[model samples]
Target: MAVSRLDVFYRRLLLTKLFIGGWGKPEDLKRIFEFRKIIGDRERCKSLVPKDYPVYINKTEDLTDCQIHDGFFMSPLEHLVPGILPPEAVKARFQFIVPKKWQRNRPVCIHLAGTGDHFFWRRRTLMARPMIKEAGMASLLLENPYYGYRKPKDQRRSSLKNVSDLFVMGGALILESTVLLRWLERDGYWPLGMTGISMGGYMASLAVTNWPKPIPLIPCLSWSTASSVFTTGVLSKAVNWTELEKQYAINSVYEEEIIKLLEYCGADSFKMMPNLLKNVNSLEHLLGLSGDHEVSVSQYSKTQMEAEVDGGLQGYRAGEREQQLSSVNSKGTSLDTVTR
Candidate 1:
């Protein structure tokens, strides 16, 4: 289907407005992605997490579709920075689901959800498991910091106010993912991968960077550079850019120390290329260790600079990334990466 010329003109006009209305200094961008020294730091990877942090499997019940293991882990962030974490973020939560057919050496994808994504929106991930079971893999869908049990009681769904809240979300998720992945490894899940759609993709990217070993990194509907999303995408219209600018000034983003602090965050100057390259190296490692290269790009768009995964073309996502409804009941169907 062809896009209407009027819609293109409207979007271009919106982009123009975005540039003039909200473009902040380069220094301000740092505050968003690197406000915390621990945002993407491998050295601080799970450092806040303690040894033998408890996992409470409060409830486990067998369902018709699959068996669910619902649980929570101690929030390392609360301990790492006293009195700073939101009350709801004090514990990391997760829902681990697997088909009854799950057995040894099955692949597990650490599935992530997008920002403010909760309630009915979660079914998008849960529905993928039957297909995974057909392929003999397991799905571990993690609840992000600001979603599920980690959400503050006062904050509405996906409602994170203040610039500090955003930093806390990123920091907490990065740490939480590390802890979960480590636990999964200890339990012996081979060829594990991380994937998510949109902001979840960004979080997954950050998580893989801190991971020492190579694993699959599939971020559907997301790009290496997030600054563009906040500054130019349709989301810009929803986010309060002026408020963020004021917060930057208050945080002293222009201070020389602040600049140096962010610059120290990476080898790629926080453009996410270092993390992206790390993902590529991990892909090579997966090939050596598992003898299979699974890159499933479910959807593609040229304007987004998204590379094809499984021969996806234009808007037609032609691949077996997600098992079709008919295939779910069929045995021996394998899954590649986590699809949102």
Candidate 2:
């Protein structure tokens, strides 16, 4: 039987998610490295640090002296992929606000902004200034990829036209977040937490979940599972599916095939459980559940074994890890998976 266009697109998404979710495994990592090597030529990975970015510090001199510092920030460090554009094609700025008294030792809170563009968080930082001041914690804000100062002028609004672009941008943002966090940690600033709303929130969740070195994260107003959005009919509007499908139709014939592959691989199902659980553990267990009420663990495990005959055990293990991670609430929120 032939698959529909939608099914193929779904499969592509599944494969992409599986690839990203499995990034930490040695074998999976090797596969990714190989894949990149085949596609990326011999070019060196892109640098997370920009050239000649300045750092600024502002101090408030009342009874309690507070300070704000600015510099280039990198987060979720991974290998960078160079663009076809010039070296200066993308530029970004990052700012940190801290209480002057605690400058010697302070936990850092990195703020990621939502969809409008890069540097949108700059204004958001201003809005959050009073709360940050009162809380007496240092706050850092960095640019989102393809937004604000980081966006290449020629690509304005163009990047948002495709779903693949969104995923690539998200991956880049994740890489940037990791790199920035590591850089700050090396400089003696501890990453206390990360917070964002909407798209930023989604990115924040990904960073926390996939960080090479874990960091506390507070992701507001974001769903836990990609499946929930995509399968629940909400994706059509949230992601502008109509537009995405149109673009994919024009750009590539394999889009449908990829989507179908993702669906068969259960990407849609894996993406939705987090939001439904509200808490993490239940979410994880649910994800790990390979069978319905009628099926037993042995049966499910056997089924998984069958699925892995050709794909390798990494896919099964990836599913298990995602479930395990989802079940635990690392953020200590009211929605505690353990306690509940």
Predict model 1's lDDT versus the native. 0.57
Q: What's the distance in Å from true for residue 42, model 2?
A: 24
Model 2's lDDT to the true fold? 0.47
The lDDT per prediction is: 0.57, 0.47
Write down the TM-score for model 2. 0.52
Model 2 lDDT tens row, 1-340: 3545774574454311211111122233223333333222212323333423233334332324455455553322223444411233234456666666553457778778764645634544464465456665677777766566666554434234323344445555555565566666766886467888766787777665545455788877776644334423223223433443344446433333332222222144334433433444454466675446335644444465345442544565565565434321221111110000
Which 10 successive residues of model 2 have the least lDDT summed? Answer: 331-340
In terms of TM-score, the best-performing candidate is 1
TM-scores of the models, in the order given? 0.63, 0.52
- Encode model 1's per-residue lDDT on 113-223: one tens digit a residue: 875566323633454565555666667777876677677676544655433555566666777787777777777777788888888888788778878788999898877
